[model samples]
Target: MIQPTKDEIRGWLSEARNELRSERFRRRLLEHELCSAKRALGNAVLKGQINVPIEKLGELVLKLQKESETEEADM
Candidate 1:
């Protein structure tokens, strides 16, 4: 039988923990990712790679957050 290395075992455990995550915890993570994503998008727009107005960005975030909350309610 093949044995997994210590690093591989640790990675598996980390993935398993994520799979068992609570909705509240997931929502918190979503919020963190949302912030980072917005920052990245802003940088991309500044670099001229994407074109998005400030008002549009705000609206998009609001729509995404509302959808996320609805999904969490079902979870």
Candidate 2:
């Protein structure tokens, strides 16, 4: 397995900061480019990512812009 060096991760973060600020990520709710960090978070918190079990978290998704760009079959 290839794990990123600390400096590589830091470099990615710096680039991510620019992309997130300049690109559609902050505005678009459903889609963004995926990285290991994102994949890991999604896997760890998959349940709470959508149709969340907890009330407040569900409320948070509802309160924010929530839409499905792809069908369940795709994921």
Top candidate by lDDT: 1
- Model 2: per-residue Cα lDDT over 1-75, one tens digit each: 999999999999999999887676554443444345556665667755544457865674564434343333456
- Which parts of model 1 have CA positions greater than 4 angstroms off? 1-21, 53-75
Query: What lDDT is reached at residue 44 by model 2?
Result: 65
Off by over 4 Å in 2: 24-75
Worst 10-residue stretch by lDDT in candidate 2?
64-73
Q: How much lDDT does each candidate structure score?
A: 0.87, 0.62
**Structure candidate 1, residue pairs in collision:** none
TM-scores, in order shown?
Answer: 0.40, 0.29
Model 1 residue 57 lDDT score: 78
Error of 1 at 2 (Å): 54
Tell me model 1's lDDT, rounded to 2 decimals: 0.87
Model 2 collision count: 0
Q: Give one digit per residue, the lDDT tens place, for model 1 in 12-63.
A: 9998887778766987898899889979987998898998888997898799
